[model samples]
Target: MRLATFVAFLAISTTASPVEKRADAFGIDISSHQGSNIKWSTLKSHGISFAYVKATEGRNYVNPYFKNHYDGAKKAGLLHGPFHFARPSASSGSAQASYFISHGGSWSADGHTLPGALDLEGGCAGLTKSAMVSWIKSFSSQYHSSEKRYPVLYITTNWWKSCTGNSAAFGSSHPLWLASWASSMGPLPAGWRSAAIWQYSKETGSTPGDQDRVSGGSAALKKLALGH
Candidate 1:
């Protein structure tokens, strides 16, 4: 009787959990680490709709292959944009934001261009939770001032909670590119009820880099790019 009850409980728990649902749009993110040679047209043929290319890190270190990736994606008919890897400990947020924008992280109203993203991982760079949140705010503010829209934040829930105390400060304004390399999305951070893009896998294959799914599909993705 006890074994039967345990099995039944396991079944119920499994059924109650939300699985990762497929989205209409799939994309990939790339950096200098991914090398310069990428088959963008092949990726597009394989159903890739968008891409995020790394542009800068900290207040220096621009990705040398940014143009190669960006232009390649555009030429292949995939919407694309640049992203910045944050180095909160190395410099002020505004300084880094300015550096990023000057390098390649700027956004335009072009339909094929997506808004820049901030890669906000790496254990807060040794900042306190409050300091981290303030740094993020400063970066977001600077980006918004320059681009007229807040940058998408590429972060994991665990990192957000640990680094910023899961602050809801940007949830209402910024779109989240959630990095959860798991079968389940698990719990979201404090502010966001849903992710704009969910990075579900780190495995590379036909897509080029990490795999990501746009939450609301192509329509939502276009809206993100158009700032609508």
Candidate 2:
């Protein structure tokens, strides 16, 4: 289906309602690594406002569940975005970018859904710090432009310090989506001054899948996705 029509369908289905008094808002992230079938309808009905669906990993292979969750997220009227799982084995970041494009260039389009993300965590597996940062730069540079904003760099505090200690590598311009998973949004890591989204916990909700707890609500996430 056309992207415009798909988005319009989402808008119509996502009729805003009176904000119910609640203690907090929630979001979910699905990926191939976490093998579980998601009931998008159930999530939506249960007040899920946003979701991050894994798109691709390494230089080959898109997430098998990507399209399913992508369409499901749209159908559920959730603010949606795609994230790439950075592979330490990959030769270059541009190679990873090429892989991502081949998997889903829809993310490259301006003003569409949420900004793409780079899932940067875990051990180097073999790559050096310079190689890892080079990959990051290549990936970021691919989408870096006045017209096209670079994807948010998704990283844990320790991972950032170990992999890319240089804050200036990403500069101050790119939006950061830090994964702290702390009790509260306390003092962030050395390089990170602010975060667009704070992934607070892996244990959340009365749902089945391993979900991530976030600080913002549906409205806040929707604003981020639509750039409003």
Which candidate achieves the best lDDT against the true structure? 1
| Model 2 agreement with the true structure over 1-228: per-residue lDDT tens digits | 122332343334334533421323556677764444556676666656678888988877688878888888877777678888888675577767667766753353333377777888777657677877777888878755322667778777677767766445673656677776666666655655767676754534432333444445555665566544
Candidate 1 stretches greater than 4 Å from native: 1-22, 204-208
- Estimate the TM-score of every prediction: 0.87, 0.76
Error of 2 at 69 (Å): 0.6
lDDT of each: 0.83, 0.65
Candidate 1 residues 1-228, lDDT tens each?
Answer: 122332343234324533522245778788877777777775665557899999999986999999998999999999998999999999999999999999989999988889999999878788999999999999989999999989999999999999999899989999999999888788999989898888987744432247788866788899999988
Model 2: colliding residue pairs: none
Give candidate 1's TM-score: 0.87
Relative to the true structure, candidate 2 has a C-alpha RMSD (angstroms) of 7.3
